[model samples]
Target: MNRFDTDLIIAGGGLAGATLALALARVVPSLRVTVVETFPLSADALPEHYQPSYDARSTALAWGSRLIFEELGLWPRLSEHATPIRQIHVSDRGHFGATRLNAGDHGQEALGYVADNRWMGLCLMRELLETGVQWQAPAEVVDMTPETEGVRVALKRGTETWSLSAQCLVVADGGRSGLREALGFQTRNHSYGQNALIANVSTGESHRFTAFERFTDAGPMALLPHGTTTRAGHQSALVWTLTDEALDEVLALSDPQKCQRLQERFGWRLGRFTRIGECSHYPLKLTTVDEAVRPGVALVGNAAHALHPVAGQGFNLALRGLMTLVEQLRQAVEQGQSLGDLQVLGRYQRLHRQDWQQTVQFSDSLIRIFGDAPAPVAAARDAGLVGLDLLPGAKRWFARKAMGLGGRRAVISKPGVARREPAGHE
Candidate 1:
């Protein structure tokens, strides 16, 4: 038998990595876990762009994700900063078609919640500290070696070099996962020839807890409800997709000038777009790893798949997959099975395969179908929206997919109660 320093080691202390530790700590109390992070855990110690939590961006948490957070006892802190999405309005600009999805339609409290990355991180950070998981921050993973029963991780912290071993290694690093690449994982990437510009914008009329997704010639533009500004007025986080030919010109515009351009594209849905925050842009791509696990190594979050932001499904899909992974690990521990065993990791990959494939197809198809500018395509898009609105069954299906409540869900019976494991883990 081989002994390891820790039961599991999670690389990348971003949202996925940190959340994985916290979730496992709650369910698998005896398992020793450690997290390796490159950024400082202290929020005040880093700039907005550098901070893992304050990446000048916001995330739309599906209703299912909220349940996962609630089960982990992190929702109370997060809800304080989250803006509920009571309704979602989707349309195509200059088209006579639109659709609306309300929380009342599905018996959910709200369709979903929108939270800034910084505050959400703060909430997760609080829970992370309580978990007592070992943390190695301001540190980078220099190299990793996968053995028959465990993995050896090399860390470079300033002038010091440290080595650690874990029974199982989880690579939750971001899309450009250095650790994953070092471990010989293959990734397929397809560039969409588009760029996403994100920022917070103040509007003339109140957002009324409504989110908007408007399709434009440039691309899909989304404005999600954000919390109130210091002045007590409404704000919305903007995610505008544009072509590469327009990226340079758009990013070069002044705040007010950018707001004007946004108004011209988005129309008077929220009346006039007033104040705008600092803008950030990133190229769009569809990235998927060929394999999510091998023997002692398991991949999670963006390291496994990075999808287009068109449907706001990236984080939601990742969260669902994380829940499945946590459940499998808990089952392994209860059955006295090795966490690093190929059987245990292979089950997780099989369970998550369907959800992964569906989400990627949904996001990729939206980009390709909407990106083409033609009369027939425009007519088809308009008809789809109109049909979706008129058909209750179709509308419910669409709402379920958008709200992340369509598939099988992991249940949390009550606070402090161990979840019952599903059968078939032998």
Candidate 2:
């Protein structure tokens, strides 16, 4: 085994891991940090079909996440491919629409933006160059053993094995975290028994920079606008949840058939949903670990909790968790990374309860409220939305929470991120 040394060793290079690396670079510049990513980087952009159709399952970035990206200077690169979500229309199926949210309510341009994950992934890699962090892709942590002094991780790359010892470790290795499991953390999972049907399409009429969330018997059918000027014409990404049985039927349809089927469900709302790219299916569920903290190691992101996509916050909270940990570690650097001991872990636990649990509970409640076909449940939820419109204070709180600004530390939205006109447009 080859011996390696670093102040911190982060396993997994997905959004959570990447965020942790960048946050550390910014907040604790002198700390030695290295990321071990399983997925190797590729030079090719994989020419995608973006004609009238593109299968882009985009993310609805909250103000907080946007702020994080901006502070890290990753926003400029990603802004080119992202579109702002101006207005949000929320209602139950058919004429009984209950509540709608306008950015004017919050004195903001839009609640968030929608951008493709793959595009953002590339932007992350581009931003890393300036972050000055070391990364090992196509790598894995085969074994990890912890001692009072620190933690040691055995990394594997093909046939080579390297042993890395660090004073602190971050576990962001996704829902099925080997380290978390081995360290005695157990997760409680709740499944919605529904899958999200995602795709991108052209709109007949302009989307007017509006995003929509329409709850139905099956689940929510959301439309997030991609208001990009370089990409002329109105475009929107779809996240349509379906019953397990309906999911099978939708997934079985051919690409062309899917576009038509989606148009039928949407009723020409976006100009007949003319085209589609690759249709992907993912089941919705919640995986939360009650014990996410231990000595020398603390889990972040999906490793700590994996939530449903109804609110598109699964990754957002992960980003927030990493950011919080970075801030805590950065400030307590005199105490060293591992010195973030149990007390520091307590801080992380507290923030997780406030920031992440909110989204998980909100999304879970939505899945339960909308997933049920029972008449009483539907009626009750409808009334809830109706009541929300009448309750301004409640709506304001809801908007603030959704924007990821409710946390005590403003975990995700740190107030420094300012809106800038995206390139290729203004």
Candidate 3:
């Protein structure tokens, strides 16, 4: 038998990594977990309370994700700042086709919720302070080596460097993860030849808790209802897709000029764009790794896969994958198996591969089918949108997929509850 310093070591303390740490603490209390992050994790390092910023970046949490956080007992806090997406209106610019999905029709409170990234991180960190998980932050994993028993990782904090061994290593780093490349994980990248300009815009009319997805000859754009502590009705987070040349031109325009351009593209919907906040842009691409796990290593979150934002499935998909990994780890503990056992890790990959494939296909197809289509294809898609509105079953299926409930979901037991082992394990 071999002994390891820590049962699991997670690199990256962002949303995915922190959520994984909390899940492990709840499901397998006895497992020793350590999280290494480049950012500071001390109490003094985090804000005492969240202050809404006009330009603060945000993420869309599908309905399934709300349930996951509820199980973790963090949803109550997360909800305080989250704006429910009561309805979603999708349309093709310059076409007569449009469709709407109402939460009431589906018997759900909201299809999803939009939350500020900083606030969500704060909520997770506050809860994690009470857990026994160890944290090494204001630090990073400088090097890693696969050993017979586990993985040996070297950490760098300030000018000091030290080594530690863990039975398993989980990488939750962002999309541009240097550690993943260092570990020799081959990736497939498909550049969409476009960039997304993200910002917060205020409208003359209230957003009314509605999200919008509009497609045009140039690209697809999404406007998710966003609210701040001081103002809760007229603001929305905008994700506007544009070509490389267009992106540079838009970024160079004055604030008023930018608003005018947005209004022209988006049309009279939401009245006129009254104001636009600071804007930032990133190149759009589809990045994936065929295999996200090894004997003692696993990748979660953006490190594992990064998809187009057209569907807002990036974080939601990553959350589901992490929860599934947690379920697999729980089973390994009950069976007296090594935490890094390849059989255990392989099962997690196999179970989640389907969801990954479906989501990637869904997002990619949306870009290809609707983005810069010819007259005939555009006409067909517009007609299809109208048909979708009239077909209840098809609309329902589309709604479910958008809400992140179309695939297998991992059942995570709440704190103090006994989790049943997955079936067929006997």
* Winner on lDDT (1 vs 2): 1
Q: What TM-score would every model get versus the actual structure?
A: 0.92, 0.87, 0.96
CA lDDT of every candidate: 0.83, 0.72, 0.89
Clashes of each: 0, 2, 0
Error of 3 at 325 (Å): 0.3
Better of 1 and 3 by TM-score: 3
Candidates 1 and 2 compared: the better one by TM-score is: 1
Candidate 1's TM-score: 0.92
Residue-wise C-alpha lDDT for candidate 3, range 1-426, written one tens digit per residue: 447888899999999999999989877888899999998766664776677999999999998888788878899999999999989999999988888999888878889999999888888888888898999987888778889868898899999999889889998888999999988999999999999999999999888899999998899999999994334499999999999999999999999999999999998779989899999999999999999999889989999999999999999999999999998998888898877889999999999899999999989998998887778988899898999899999999889888888766688765467665332111
Q: Give the per-residue lDDT of model 2 (tens digit) for 1-426.
A: 323378788888877787778777766677788888888867564334322226555777877678778777788877777777667777777536467777778877667777777777777766676776888888988767876667787889999997888777788888878767776777898887778887776767878777778777557888888747344356777888887889888879887788777766666555766566667777777888787877777888888898877777777777767777776775556564353376776777786677676677787877767664667767777888888888999888777666666553333322344434321111
Clash number for candidate 3: 0
In model 2, the worst 10-residue window by lDDT is: 417-426
Model 1: which ten-residue window has the lowest total lDDT?
46-55
- What value does the lDDT take at residue 187 in candidate 2? 83
- Relative to the true structure, candidate 3 reaches a TM of 0.96
